[model samples]
Target: MNEKNTLLPRQLGDTHIRLLRIYKVVIESGGFAASEIELNISRPAISAAISELESLLKMKLCHRGRSGFAITDQGEKVYQSTLQLLGNLENFRSEMNAINTDLVGELNIGITDNLVTNEQQRLTRSLSTLKLRAPEVVINIRMISPNAIEAAVLDGQLHFGVVPELRSLSGLTYSSLYQERSQLYCSEEHPLFDKNNEAISDSTLCEYDAVIPNYPQPIKIKHQQKKLKSTATSTDREGLAFLILTGRFLGFLPVHFAQQWVAQNRLCSIDSHNRYFDTHFFTITRKGARENLILEAYLEELEKTL
Candidate 1:
């Protein structure tokens, strides 16, 4: 029997932690080549680190070859365990920082895209306030999907998340931020682009393929009596916009975000008045977690901005 195979989890050291972090980054980035910039390391270095990790565990973690990058079953298990371990480590750091009166440590926040263009969004104002009040605290913001935001908050990987309410999760708390308006959009090359809003009936609109968000549940569209065939799906605003711009699909996008495209004649709204929906955005945090003074102060600042 190999001596390393018998090593317990508690025996992991600083080297193991470093390797785990590298592994997490590679997986999150989707591939080793894609992770180079994020990890700020060479591809060879990353591969070496992964190999070291695999050796330490005495198991293969991933498959990287011409077929493309993929995580093995053991890799998935290790990845999940790493998340829990890192989350606990973060909680410990937060607890230690809370011992002092001064706000310090990092604040991880996740948000959905396209909010920067919305006039009603107060994220910048809240961030400014946080910086002024807590100069010692480091703030990190990640642009992610609503589902990812909720999951990160639940796992303690993110201190807070800003996302539209799709469905309620049991272990999370939500605070309303603002309402966002989304309208059906089509590219200039789309068949319905130059047509008058009234001329395009439901049956006519349904003729073209619909590009929808890749949410776990079906998205509810206002005044949509008939289901349009979903030909494509995207998890982010940028991807959805790209698909719509192909002129092959129709999709819903935030009005403010679609403004520039409309101005450039790249995209246009089908009917803003009748074919739009209001989505409520909220700030989510984990329930039953120890209250950190810094997080509380930041949340207070965010509420004031709202």
Candidate 2:
């Protein structure tokens, strides 16, 4: 019997790290062609890299025969270790590079309609500053809802989110950018405008037709009012603005969006008392990544525009 070859501990080399990355791609994809697609390398190159990795480890890292390619039990352990090593390596590089001014990654921002209506000026000003400070960094904006923004950011689909601070998110870092209030609005002819009797109860307001946005916060508050039987309406705030401008119906709107209209007499607040909805609008980012300089700078500029 051949004597078992003895192995000595050795430092992992750059070649080993590269091959580990290729191996990860192959295992994640299960096919050489798929790995090629993911790694942006040729299929032959992927196969060759896996062969090199197996030789370096002196063990079968992949069971890449007949039925679709699969990794062995040992391969699974290796893959886990590779992931940890790569993750740590990346964190190290990020920490080192983050000290300098070379901002080179894409920043994905999630924006909701309410943000568009209330904080558009502030956001645009922030972007303008970013463009001058970090021209290399790309910005991708996704328009989504205040309710869904939290999950999307947590899941890494978005780098950050901006929305009305209806409340705090348990796990997120929220920075209040500006204070905003929601204004109750109606056509000039709405009877809630009797103007003589000031305060009306929920039951009294329900006697007339009302339109509402289909968002969790609004829906929750509306449902809590036991006496109101509102004909629930679902539309983006832009559509809501259009409806209000046309004298069709009434609803609560971000004060900024309706301010000009109210000044021009196109829309009127339900009560002269200005029964406004008070909430802080905020910018949210994951706690860990907020330390990234590019993100921090962007947020700093955002605070200035508030």
Number of the top lDDT candidate? 1
Candidate 1 local distance difference test against the native: 0.82
Model 2, 222-295: lDDT tens digits are: 54323334565664677677666555566777788887777776677765363456656678886664346667
Candidate 1 TM-score, C-alpha based: 0.76
Tens digit per residue, CA lDDT, model 1, 6-31: 75475777888889988987898788
Best-fitting candidate, scored by TM-score: 1
Clashing residue pairs found in predicted model 2: none
Report lDDT per candidate: 0.82, 0.69
Residue-level lDDT for 31 in candidate 1 = 85
Off by over 4 Å in 1: 1-15, 18-54, 59-84, 194-199, 217-219, 222-226
**Candidate 1 lDDT score at position 276:** 75
